[model samples]
Target: MMKRFLILSALISLSIFSSDKIGRLPVYKIAVEAVPATEEGIVLRDFIKEQIQSTSRGTISLPLKESESGNWEFDKEGNPTLETVANIKRYTDTDKLVLISTEDGQAVISFVDVLHRKLEYRNSLPDSLSKTLVSDFLGFLDKKNIYLALSETGSGSNAQLKINSLKPTYVAGEPIRFEIESAEDNYVYVVLVPENQKGEPILLFPNQIQNDNFVRKGDRVTIPDKRISFKASSVPSKDRIRAFASREEWKEFQLRGKKEDSFYRLLPPAVTGTKTTARSMTVVPNTLTASIEQSPVMEWEYQILSR
Candidate 1:
């Protein structure tokens, strides 16, 4: 029986090859089991299941199976050992498994990839677990599987933005200078995402301090432009700067100010087009609007490592 199953699995793998290659793979039957039976564990299990189903988009099917008692066997570090792997394979008749466990008030989610014989993803949960983190994890998985489509196109010949920092790395208290150049008249949006600070995105452009998100074509915008200087955060962390340029003004989202700083209070969720991943910058050929026939949008990202 075991030999027959293995032969069948190999044959199926050879026969299936969908345009979305991941979709062609056999359905991964995953058993989600928690250790010590905690409420958090149960919640996390359900959340993972939902995220997998949502992100897969019928590409990678993860059919859930009832986990038996003592199904989750892992080492002290929350990794499956050889013995545990054998047991899981024997009991589930498959290798993929999600083990959720809490240690020292930190939840650890491990996705064991049996075919690769490695832990695909392992992360310590934050104090407040949000859907963003799940999306990030799912994105990580998609990237690992070479499933993300990072393609961009449109009439962006006149729309271009260049970003440059004074230094590649900076100290906590030092001031960082940025120089931006635009090829055409465009409205720009700049956002800084700090690794140390999760879920708190910093709006650099279009703020009260620098109220000019608009720039003329062939103009260069300099940060700390004689009037203002941008200082580094007190906390030591890595950060990423994303700059977006568009021919048409973005009316879909609104930025609100609180006290001295402005933030994106209501940003519309990005719509996923066919052959494109959500949150990815994809160009739509025809918006069918008067002011915007072909809304050309361009984006650039840069990493900043701070200590």
Candidate 2:
């Protein structure tokens, strides 16, 4: 597993990559389990919303009602009955309906075409899996992978996140190298924001490693090279911070608001390392300091070093 952290709001923004043109039909409704109302549900909803819009090339509206066990009545053989489906279909006046369920480490998506009265697709996703489960089912319409369709859908769908590729040079900075050996190819995002008197603190994925972006007092520079717009200086003695992510121009996976300010926050708690371990490198700025944990690149030392 790649130590997954679901940013529910990220999906709500629907600003990330989406899969369009999976099928000609526009997706209108997505019914999720009642769990979406919880803290965890928020994250799952964002990812799901992003998936629906991207894959279906249509707008998606999530039904507000909580799902009940009887919401999807199965027949004696365990297949959902048409009669039971009719009840579900009455809520959303859309052409399609998606039934979503989640278990220990995976999410099950069932795409039902109400008009056709058939299950268009079904798939089970593993925990910490990189592939988007939402897009997978939508892509099934045209027999395509959501990941592949995301780049192809383009402007036909509004769910695309644009990424610009650029090169960055390390400048006397403490670099965090995160090697999620078992994680998916999802681009990691890193940001350094001025917090306290110690100046800006660095945050990274694979929170296991110690890597921070470095900059001089007067250096008008932003690393990862593409998000200079957000990094531009602020007035009123505002603290200037440098933010970075695995992918620049992340219109696809954007947060609806300041993630830290949301009810559902980004929690980087300590978890036992499984098959994959994350690492990072950080160079300090000026005489500022940082404390690193058990990272191999940091000489296996636990100490707070000043720049």
Candidate 3:
């Protein structure tokens, strides 16, 4: 059996792995994110940034994007979510993502290394922000020196993710119907944010009924488009819809909620995207792959507030 890869982002062409882009390397931008995004988290985020830069003596470049909202929300599983990542991408331009999360004065961090396809360097804050992480980061670059070369190729140059129609507000229990279209064939993933105060983001597409997520271009899609015994969800509890449109297959997402239940939950992505199609509240991939970051993606979101 093959090992499962995380559904972080679309894989760029394998050729970039062939050579380090004509013998060139970039300083590489690293973005630091805090889980929970509290004042302490923000403080820790800043502290770690300063410490790393100072400790590295200069090779590691971690630029705090002014566009960052510093709101690192997580799924119920206490993991950083894809929605958060997509939001970051929508707001900032970063080559690598570093997630720092702490509790009870203890901290842990994960760095997304696309070249190795692995998450690197996890230790406590202030103390662990040592030269080891920087050395490893720089060492990988110096050795493999794989930069995301995305100039000559693009997955869907003609594709666009758009909302065809959606009501600003709907009466509780009313049929939720909306329109979304893409100019080219694409794999569209959608998640629903529930109205509950402690609710997690749920995977709305690739559900039990509508298992096929590949949509043809030029045809407007009515979501929940499964051709079986189903219609729109009338839960009236969900208020937000986040959609991701990309031209490549994501890694794989694992199931969260138990089967034989009313709904299945996909806790989602252990560095891989989900494929089970189970209806579960899950997180999207925060650390995307180089190919995905280099390629075109549509992250469309809308929320209907309760009156």
Which one wins on TM-score?
1
Whole-model Cα lDDT per candidate? Answer: 0.46, 0.32, 0.43
Model 2 weakest lDDT span, ten residues long: 286-295
User: Candidate 2's residue-wise lDDT over 133-208, tens digit each?
Assistant: 5434433432212112221222222211122221121112223121211122223333332212122122332132
Q: What digit string (tens of lDDT, one per residue) describes model 1 on residues 1-307?
A: 1111111100001011111221133234455556545787777767766655554421323434444335444565556776666545653444455667655667777677655445666767663653444555554443322211111222333337766554545544455567777777888765554442233344566655667778888777775455544555444444545455666676643454455333332222232222234343221211211112133333333233344
Which of the predicted structures, 2 or 3, would earn the higher TM-score when compared with the native? 3
Scanning candidate 1 in windows of ten residues, the lowest lDDT window is: 5-14
Candidate 3 lDDT over 1-307, as tens digits, reads: 0001101111111111112133222234566766656566677677656644543312344444443455655544445466555545542455456666666755556565423223444445443443333333333332112112111122433246666555544443244555667677877765543433124345556665566778788767776553422223323333445455666755433434434322234432421233222221121112223333334433332333232
**lDDT of the structure predicted as candidate 2:** 0.32
Error of 1 at 44 (Å): 17
Best model number under lDDT: 1
The clash number for model 2 is 35
Stretches of candidate 3 exceeding 4 Å from the true structure = 1-159, 194-198, 226-238, 255-257, 260-307
**What ranking of all candidate models by TM-score puts the best one first?**
1, 3, 2
User: Distance (Å) between predicted and true CA of 11, model 1?
Assistant: 50
